[model samples]
Target: MLSYALLVHAAPYSEQGALSALRFAQAAVAQGHRVSSVFFYRDGVHNASTLMAPPQDEVHLAEGWRALAQEHGTELLVCIAASLRRGLMNAEEGVRHGREAHNLEPPFVLTGLGQLVDAMQANDRVITFAP
Candidate 1:
């Protein structure tokens, strides 16, 4: 089976990048290809924010990505720098920055660019979905 690394680099609702990456990941799993990891960078870290509550009619892109990660046991990594810059911090980060609590949820880990480079090195394909 082919292994893939899905790199998402856009905000959740602004454009189709996040949604497109999710759809592509689902299709890849359906077809039996392994999605080794999903790396959220730049504005893509917004997908892991637990505070997002889109309107009823609009699709909840963040929830969808979270669900996919849980369902497939996929490694979902949010770049620490990108995440913090955008106010998407995990428990440790939130504490360090003096925030009351963290909003980033499980299955979404805070990591560095090294993970991205490693994923690209190991995967059969490194697919990027940008703004």
Candidate 2:
């Protein structure tokens, strides 16, 4: 089975790219393929914000990704630079930046771009859902 690294480049609700990545991942896993990592870059980093409280009627995109990670061990990697720029951050980052809270949580890791490179290197295929 081929391993895949997925790249998401848009906000979760602002465009279809994020959901597309999720559905594609589900399909891939069901087909017996591996999703090594889902890299959220640019506006896509918003997908990792634990603070997102969408309407009850809407699907919680972040939770969907989290559940996928929990079940399959797929890494949910968010670009630190992109996340910080958009006011999304982890616990350590919040403290470093002198903030009282953070949105980046477990299962959703705030990492540097090198991790994306590493994911690209480690996987057999890369599928990008861009804005």
Candidate 3:
């Protein structure tokens, strides 16, 4: 099984990057390949926000990503700088920023850029899906 790392750099609904990454990860798992991690950067940090409420007719890409990670046990790491700038903070970050609460969910970690570097080191393929 090939170990893959998916890098997403687009916002949740504005483009197909998140969906494509999700589908690719799912297909990889179905084909017996291992998805090492999903690294969210730039506007992709929105994918980890629990506060997202897309229109009823629109696809909830954030939830879709969350489900994929939960089902496949994939590590979802959002760039800490990106997420903080976008106000998509985790519990600890929220406290540090003097916010009331955080919106990030489980399996989606607010991490440093080092995580992506680590993924690149460990994964055989590091594919980037940008807007």
Candidate 4:
């Protein structure tokens, strides 16, 4: 089975790119392929925001991605530069910035572009979902 890595460049709420990536990953896993990681960059960093509170009737892409990670062990990574520019921060960043809260949580890690390069190098396929 081919191992895949996904790069998402769209926000969870505003575009279909993120959703497409999620479905692609799910389908790949169902077909017995391995999805090694999903790297969220550009506006895709919004998917890692814990403050997202979509309507009950809507499909929460963040939660869906989180569930995918929990069940399939896919590494979900958010771009550090993009996340900071958009005001998304993990606990360590929050503490460093003297903020009281952080929207980034478990199952979603903030990392550098080097991680993306690694994903590209390590996986058999590197797919990008962009808006």
> How would you order the candidates by TM-score, starting with the best?
4, 2, 1, 3
C-alpha displacement of 29 in model 1, angstroms?
A: 0.6
Off by over 4 Å in 2: none
**TM-score per model over all chains:** 0.95, 0.97, 0.93, 0.98
Q: By summed lDDT, which 10 consecutive residues of candidate 2 come out lowest?
A: 10-19
The local distance difference test score of model 4 is 0.94
lDDT of 1 by residue, 20-118 (tens): 999999999999998989999999999998988999998898788877788887899999999988889989888899999898978899999999999
lDDT of 4 by residue, 1-131 (tens): 99999999988879999889998999999999999999999999999999899999988888988988999899999999999999999999999999999999989999999999999999999999998
| Poorest lDDT segment (10 consecutive residues) of candidate 1 | 62-71
Per-residue alpha-carbon lDDT of candidate 3 for residues 25-96, written as tens digits (9 for 90 to 100): 889999999887999999999888888898899878877777778787789999999988888988888888
Q: Write the per-residue lDDT of candidate 2 for residues 1-131, one digit (tens) a residue.
A: 99999999979889988889999999999999999899999999999989889899988999999988999899999999998999999999999999999989999998999999999899999999987
The pairs that clash in candidate 2 are none
- Which ten-residue region of model 4 has the weakest summed lDDT? 10-19
